[model samples]
Target: MDNHEFESESYEEVEEDDVGHDESPQVITIVTTLPSARSHRLRTRLSLPDSGYEIDNVQSTVSANMLKILKKTFSIPNNVFLHLSQDNDLPSFPPEDKVTFCSDFFRFGVRLPLHSFINRVLCHYKLAPSQLCPNGWRILVGTLTLFRSMYNDDHSLAEFQYLNCLKASVCSRWYYFHPRPNVSKFILDLPDNNKNWKQKWFLISGSWGGELREDGVVRSVPTHFGIPGLIFVLYVHTCSSYASLHV
Candidate 1:
């Protein structure tokens, strides 16, 4: 189980004729371990082909019993494709190209070209890029808070307040960036506004996902490949085959 002793091949040296489009591009595989409350471990394998990448697994084929166990453990969707590189030869991809994550696991980063992926992640999650940072953080924090409140004992009011709190958190965080024209001065003139001050401004803004876009997409399209272990495996394969580019 040494990290250094991953599956790898020796460098065979790329031939002069292997430099151009006529020659097949190198194939890289990434294997990863995904943490889930369900099974003891969910191993995943990803292979990057010249055209694109595919996911697989190394353990026994995911049977009905295994899937049922997973579903009982986690409320995740049941229909998932599982493959192992050992069953089928891994695919390949050009070094210059990249793979984009269509799933919730990837916020804004691509899978290929590790450096670019890291850079994009830092910019989207950590760095303040323009005015979108506040809204982005609001969504992130609100989602986390909502998950936390899920453990609360059944109370109708508590559930309602939980949703409201999530909305409020998102709206308040965003308001720090874009402040609305206040009717505060006009509050004295309009006494009704003062009395009904606990308005649903936050709900209107935070709940409206259709009105706004998440990174230029109409919806938050998350590609659920299921296991991180598969991805980790593929990444390791890619690195291991670094010298095999010549072969």
Candidate 2:
């Protein structure tokens, strides 16, 4: 979708009392199925909010936008997009896509300039085009700044569903697995008995076999969830740790 199309739609101004509310713009991203002879429904509607669900969180719209933007800039010489698309070895660094920089690893392999890094990060996240606004840009700036400071390891990605009674149902279906009994127990046992809560870990283990490096210690790198899933899992584990301590 183009900026003009997004701007045409109207939104009602929501009034706030005392506390500040999230200011990221709301977007109704419509994903239309590729037309086939038998297809009747033209499109599907997905309303994505900026705060919780980052751009990369949604598969349909955000991914589509990435593909679009990627195609458009793929030819730019000496640009990250160009390097990502090139086949042969080049003197310049490959595109940002090849690099694994996130909130966790700030000044790692890539030495992207502040604006360049921000642009690329936003692109990777598939943030809305309008986030270029002063307020949204400020938030984006702060987020990136924080990422640079905490480069302990790779920044893991997680998908956090807003807290509510129906959270169990939401999470169960999302993970495509049945709920474990310990889910409740895990929460009840939160660290320091923080009732307000934080996150819950999605226990996942699969075939990324454990191996001993040159040193004898064994390290098991997970193969199931990528950057996105890892982020969500980290959040859950962090929150659950605090919760468990209390119980």
Candidate 3:
């Protein structure tokens, strides 16, 4: 048989499966072209409001499929693809805030924007204030790098800079000011000393001191002691909490 005859036979064989089946139009469309009607189908499948699929169960498959679409649709470079696909731990669907942000961002794109469509995208991944650990920081850095690759225009560059500044500000506040010593321990333990010595150093440096305000706000005392002082304070606070728990 000629090449055309072989291709026609292959198409007929594929259609033969659908002959007796009662497949919905949606199923047929999803199987044919994901990008053409992606927004509606994906949103319905993901079912954000229904608590549909467990995040862990769907994350890998959803991310892989969405990344495939993004790479093809945007003609993203291989380097850019590597940057996004490297972080396998990112959620399949981002939080509502990021979903909203991305939906608005891509409103004018070819397809009708769906919040879930944007939610599946890697760039929309957001780290919670409490989740600002080493791994989370790596994700954020990777996301910023990906944005740089995706958006090369001057306007987008400014926006990228703004995002970086915002991330840095949020991280500094959570890492430095928050009372979660265990979370901050990695940085706090950097000084070359034992835990006891570190605690004593915190006491001596006046970094352990804070003042309670009328509004029930406790502000750290600014000793002008800089970064070392901050780490000492966090170390002492974490140690004290653990000690209290044991007692």
Candidate 4:
């Protein structure tokens, strides 16, 4: 990956919103009964007003868009695409065909400056045409800028799936073998609590909380009920002391 591919997009580069940071995500309210999804209609048809759902909370199109970006990015470098076409050594970072990230990480329908988005992507997570190379070197998309030097720490790579739920299929992501569980069916360090989760987790595939950004930005984020799941956040505190780190 080239350094130019990802840029540090601070507020300076992008037009700063006159609102607060916490009010960055877009939310939609569905007032009337939602219509069942059909192939012929535009996705915008799903955005119902009044009845609310946090469109970003569950992704239906982001996986496709992100995947498309990675695929396109991989093909940009000369011979990179031609090379990875033969092997998955350039492993797809998350590898899973589904999405694992929750609202705590990425927002939907929020239009950000190109540099800003690039900076956010490089904050964490690796990207590939569709594979991880033998050297374990891959491009890191920053959560908020990555130096893009293709650094690889085998130890860190080994734990990639652990820290990231975006690594596995929904069903297995909450299993005993997983490092973390995004679903309420499981709890960290409490393996016993996750037993028979297959029976407990339901596919209501409905219910999305609506958020009105404090920044006053409105976005029409696309969504679907295909992979219905619940989000259960787990907080771990080993000590009473608090410390802050700067990068």
Candidate 5:
């Protein structure tokens, strides 16, 4: 496809609007892509009617109700996480507003732009937020590592996801974040004192994972996809949509 040429994808219909609301409808136009086996994007421009939202001098807080509207429009789950188009920023999920939520992204200076849903991602979450980040308690409670404990509820399928090696009825749940950069070769968050973590970083990926040695050895196992075409795709497609907030 050419850079200027566009592709269109048909999306499902939102339910009929109820007549009982006193406030007129509001619209939120969203353009996002789904994860699949194809190269093309599944896109839509959804108008959220009466989708409650709030804005202040400092922040924009979208209503949890909008999740329902989005699910209706896109045939996705209401609890699915919504990213502000930045693959690095922590995604927004249920029970919290998109902007005001306390997140790793905010702690690391990742900001939200206006029209955040533009090129945003609708992610299906399987793990808790704390699990995704981590708060320490490794030995007593177990390190919050990245192996799969898929929340698909069926233990057999979860086992299948983890190659029957680690994900067997584990107490943790699996979550999906898009693939990040530099897994095989380099990078480290560098655990400090009690601020972020107490111990050295433990490396975790898909079905395979490992505890990194203090000597900086590559003990961690490979992810589902290695440095093949996926990493190249991410490298080329790392987006700038979440750059800054619109004033």
Candidate 6:
């Protein structure tokens, strides 16, 4: 929704702490829902202490002040919202109606655990506070940064898509599939004549801790959880090594 559509009635603000010092502003918490019909609820806690600014949890409310600030500052969509809960448990899969934005090779959905999501948002918020608001703008900007990085890869769009799909499939608890075969084929199909294939393969392999030997054998690294279900990384390393030797 456009920023102009945000009116005063779209959010509610609550004063959590009274102003004690002249330099310290009251701790205010704003709660509101997104503008779209499918928009989720959001809560933003703003604390203007003498040292600096701080953001806390998400809550419920009716006014649009926070939403307006977020829209004007970050241009975030209604599909994303802040969830400030401490729970780390995640469902087997994201909900059918949930929205997702990927970052750092991870697919973060609305239904994903809130702790990791909030931490990622906070990292960007600390770097560029002026570009973000207490609303979900931090998360939006962080997600955009990740998306841009993925797009900057020199590989073909199809390869990029396959990598993203492979990452999502591996990282998601609910994604059940045999990724090894497809991953192997994708690696083997890379052009042996391209020198850049080695670099691309290294990036993919390093991310998943897979390795390729000089003789072209691909092996998976041990993970804390167990043997990784997705072995596409092995293929990537092998392809990269092959391209390097051939080129």
Best by TM-score: 1
The local distance difference test score of model 4 is: 0.23
lDDT per residue for candidate 4 within 35-149, as digits (tens), equals 2476211112232232122221222322334534543643323322211111111011111122122211112111111123322222222221111111111112321122223
Give one digit per residue, the lDDT tens place, for model 6 in 176-198: 11123244322222222322211
- Cα deviation of 176 in candidate 1 (Å)? 31
Evaluate all candidate structures by whole-model CA lDDT and list the values in order.
0.25, 0.24, 0.24, 0.23, 0.23, 0.24
How do all models score by TM-score?
A: 0.20, 0.18, 0.18, 0.18, 0.19, 0.18
Model 5 ranges with Cα > 4 A deviation: 1-100, 114-131, 134-183, 189-247
Which is the better candidate, 5 or 6, if ranked by TM-score? 5
Count backbone overlaps in model 4.
31
Worst 10 residues of 1 by lDDT: 199-208
Worst 10 residues of 5 by lDDT: 114-123
Give the lowest summed-lDDT range of ten residues in model 3: 197-206
Per-prediction tally of clashes: 27, 20, 0, 31, 0, 9
lDDT of 2: 0.24
Give the clashing residue pairs of candidate 3, or none: none
Error of 1 at 56 (Å): 10
Stretches of model 4 off by over 4 angstroms after superposition: 1-165, 170-193, 201-208, 212-214, 218-247
Give the poorly placed runs of model 2, Cα more than 4 Å off: 1-77, 80-126, 159-247
TM-score attained by model 5: 0.19
